[model samples]
Target: MCFGPFKRVCHWGPLVALGIIKAITFSTVTCLSQWWPPQQSASGTLVFVAFSSSAVLTLYFFLQAMFTGPGVLPAGWRPEVEGDTRYLQYQKH
Candidate 1:
């Protein structure tokens, strides 16, 4: 039913989601900036707003990787082995 190293699930899903979210955020920010007051335009406020938002998203992914090792692997269907001597022997000391 699945393919490749991670089976059917892969990093592509998250990458696509991030792309959509970033596009939406960028569009919303651009729209809002068009209506900002003249004084605000000269202050670089909109640029800072967009930059910080993107930075936060980038930082969040790094933090997530730190906390969670990686994507979940599909469970293998092999029968459960409990206290098997051969299984225990295979483990590195």
Candidate 2:
């Protein structure tokens, strides 16, 4: 279903998503500079910091999700304890 983690970056969908992210970040910085002017206003600086931090953190989390999935349970996997299979048996809907 998937390739190696680094190779995953080569896929088109994610590449496009990353490009979108970069574009949005660039546009946000551009807008902040024009209207808020981080250099001239404390509020602007704080807003920039907040937005930038959120963006960076978003990338960080995204990287984690992309590279190493949150967690997975193998298909048909079962607990080791005896009689557990009975608990797992559910009628097909």
Candidate 3:
């Protein structure tokens, strides 16, 4: 079977979306850092907050992509699973 134009477009759509997400995330983190003084503690805190927040957001995107659908996540981001499935268990809402 042949995939045709749609296959190619779909393949690149995620990457483009991911790029956009990264840019936005970076900008947001940078802006947030200004709220803290430029001391060593502030720098460290900024790093920690940015990394942790990014990880959480990325995970959310991945979950949305899966159980919900691909478009649930930003274009390029994808979710990953590992271990005893603890990462996937959801609390009943």
Top model by lDDT, which number?
2
Q: Tens digits of per-residue lDDT for model 2 on 1-93?
A: 456667878889888988988899989989988888898999999999999998898888877878885565677788899677777754465
Candidate 3: deviation at residue 48, Å? 6.6
Residue 67 CA displacement from its true place in model 2, Å: 0.3
lDDT of 1 at 33: 65
Pairs of residues clashing in candidate 3: 14-75, 14-76, 18-76
Candidate 1 overall lDDT versus native? 0.58
lDDT of each: 0.58, 0.83, 0.59
TM-score of each: 0.38, 0.71, 0.38
How far residue 43's Cα lies from its native spot in candidate 2, in Å, is 0.3
TM-score of candidate 2 relative to the true fold? 0.71
Poorly placed runs, candidate 3 (over 4 Å): 1-10, 38-51, 63-93
Clash statistics: count for each candidate: 0, 0, 3
Expressed as tens digits, the lDDT of each residue in 7-62 for candidate 3 is 43354566576667778777766765666544658676877577768757895775
Model 2 C-alpha RMSD to native = 6.1
- Poorest 10 consecutive residues of model 1 by lDDT? 83-92
Ranking by lDDT: 2, 3, 1
Runs of candidate 1 exceeding 4 Å displacement: 1-10, 37-93
